[model samples]
Target: MGLINMATYLDIIRGTYEGTSEENGKRLRDALATDAVWTEAAGFPYAGTYVGPEAILANVFHRLATEWIDYRATVHTYVADGDRVAAFGTYSGTYRTTGKTMEASFAHLYRLENGKIVNMQQFVDSAMVRAAMD
Candidate 1:
């Protein structure tokens, strides 16, 4: 199947966090290609370029699972152009260490191929996240 458009992509995003079930995680994982690349914005705690699904799972998802409580991305808008999708949203979470809740606007850009995400780049307010964690 060809890569999905922005609406379907957003639906997939919502499905990932709709429940605390392994099925959601599996769905999210299934959308990623093995050779996918994820780039986290610099200055964030887990900032770096993660290559491949395993590396992304370790560096990005693992950190989110450990460091934040009730972490959620509330998408406000989506724009799609061919296989590229842009999602505008806010990340809301409580920093596990400080117990301080924070909300930061973010833009996530994704490139998909054959219904799988091949690359992603995230933009967010690193300073706000740092302050929340402090």
Candidate 2:
């Protein structure tokens, strides 16, 4: 297993957020291994622990698409050390159900191994999101 560069990992994450094609999704899947785990801290509406790259692809990507018409994440700060990368960002989207727009700040800690994302934990402002939905 080779060490994955932090910048490259960030680029992959950025691409996943910005890319709108099926090819992009495929690229993300290629970047991540089959056993990758993604977890979100408690408090957010979608807060729960998810395991496996397939789950992330399904719940984080597919399920989100159902709730949001257009979603995008903008990175504010990113720091990497060893095999872990931490990113602070804002995620903005239009809710498909109400057509309401919302933006929330978020932080993510990612662990990489063998040039693939092995684990990810996300933290977001749930109160703000709940207020926006109200």
Candidate 3:
């Protein structure tokens, strides 16, 4: 019984940040609840509240792919509290336009329901990301 593959909040959330950008994106969309809300931090390049997987894929995933070269989120730690999970990590990449590189710390919070992410919030130092673009 204990061996059952019950997915924890952190496991569901880790799917969103584990693989390559494209692969991780697929996992993210797959783990999203029907009305999931994905919030990008204000001042972030893709800052906004995206409802549903489609919106998030279009606004955040697609833009990141096109605007940044080799962009990635590497999670160093994961903390789970009941239905909530927090991923502490770093973002690194080179801006397509500027060809400058950036490494910024990030924290992603997720609330899951029935093994799917119902809400998510992003926290990061936008200035560090902006420095690379400029």
Candidate 4:
């Protein structure tokens, strides 16, 4: 008989953040299911539901990389329930155009299936993020 292997939802979600930025990104992209959907907060600049890893990279992560300086999401806590995991954190960055910095609380809720993230929704203080931009 062969043993079955599995990773808990918490472990899968936590692995996405508890690594170097490059590593984290790689882990995140690797963890996304082919048809995964990522939602950005309504008031945020990239406010839309992006589908698939390529779409997410183009719509969100690539913009963040190009538009901010020293941008970081510092996760403070994580909660896992069933197939959902929530990460509570603070986002800090300096807007490249305005040269202003802001820090705001943020939360990300993720739903997983078969060890891959199927959906993710972000909650953040868009005003705080916009303050830095303006």
Candidate 5:
């Protein structure tokens, strides 16, 4: 069997951060498996588990879009092995509720199956978010 490469993972990451437009969202959906699961770090306002593309879109993506202005994940480094990819980045946005802006480091781990992302876990500085919320 051939091994999964990092390029594909990078493509997914690139597409995800480009924007939240419908076409961009569609690219993200196409890269995810039907039963994909996304776990957000605890302490985050949207902290929870999201299953499937629809759930992820509704619970996580939608919240981000509605609650934050110019929310973007800017990746700085990428590490990959086998079907797993670890992306290090920063997330910057302005919280709608408080009109507070924040820039925090983040890491996202992705596991792919059949060339599609099946699982994802996010790590971020919750303190930064809390500060903004406060």
Candidate 6:
């Protein structure tokens, strides 16, 4: 398959958040190459760089499973060009560890190759999270 258009790419990203099942996660994984690299900005305690699909599944998704009672991301804006898509959104959830509920802004940059995500970078309002925990 070749590169998917920007609208299609946005749809896929939205689907990843909207679909509430392992199947969705699997679908998202399928769209990602095995060697994909996912990086999150510093400041957020759980933020770290993850390489490969398996690493993201283990470190990012799995960690989210334990930390949040419920988590959802709402897209505020999306821009795409060729094989790259950038999304801005807010993630809201209840922190399982401290029972602190939060809604914070975030932005993600995704690079796709042959219809699969090969790299991703994320930025979140970690300072707000830190204050919420205090």
Quickly count the clashes in candidate 1: 0
lDDT of 4: 0.90
By summed lDDT, the worst window of 10 consecutive residues in model 4 runs over 1-10
Which digits, one per residue and each the tens of the lDDT, describe model 6 over residues 1-134? Answer: 26567778777666666666576687778887888989978988668888888899888888777778777777778888777888899978887778888888999898887677888899999887666566
TM-score, cand. 1: 0.85
Model 5 Cα lDDT, one tens digit per residue, 20-120:
56767888888889999999999887899999999999998898889898888888888877778888989889999999999999999988876788999
Q: Is candidate 5 or candidate 6 better by TM-score?
A: 5
User: Number of clashing residue pairs in every model?
Assistant: 0, 0, 0, 0, 0, 0
TM-score, structure 6 vs. true: 0.87
Clashing pairs in 2: none
Off by over 4 Å in 4: 1-7
lDDT of each: 0.81, 0.76, 0.87, 0.90, 0.85, 0.79
Tens-digit lDDT string for candidate 4 (11-99): 77888888887988999999999999999999998999999999999999999999999889999999877778899999999999999
- For 25-98, candidate 1 gives per-residue lDDT tens digits of 67778888889989999987789999888899888887887889987777777777777778888888999999
**Residue 101, model 2: Cα distance from true site in angstroms:** 1.2
Candidate 6 runs further than 4 Å off: 1-3, 21-23
Best by lDDT: 4
Better of 2 and 3 by lDDT: 3
Using TM-score as the yardstick, the better of models 3 and 6 is: 3
Give stretches of model 2 more than 4 Å off.
1-3, 18-24
All candidates: TM-score: 0.85, 0.83, 0.92, 0.93, 0.89, 0.87
Cα error, residue 102 of model 5, in Å, equals: 0.4
Whole-model alpha-carbon lDDT for candidate 2: 0.76
- What is the lDDT ranking, best to worst? 4, 3, 5, 1, 6, 2
lDDT (0-100) at residue 70 of candidate 6?
Answer: 74
Better of 3 and 5 by TM-score: 3
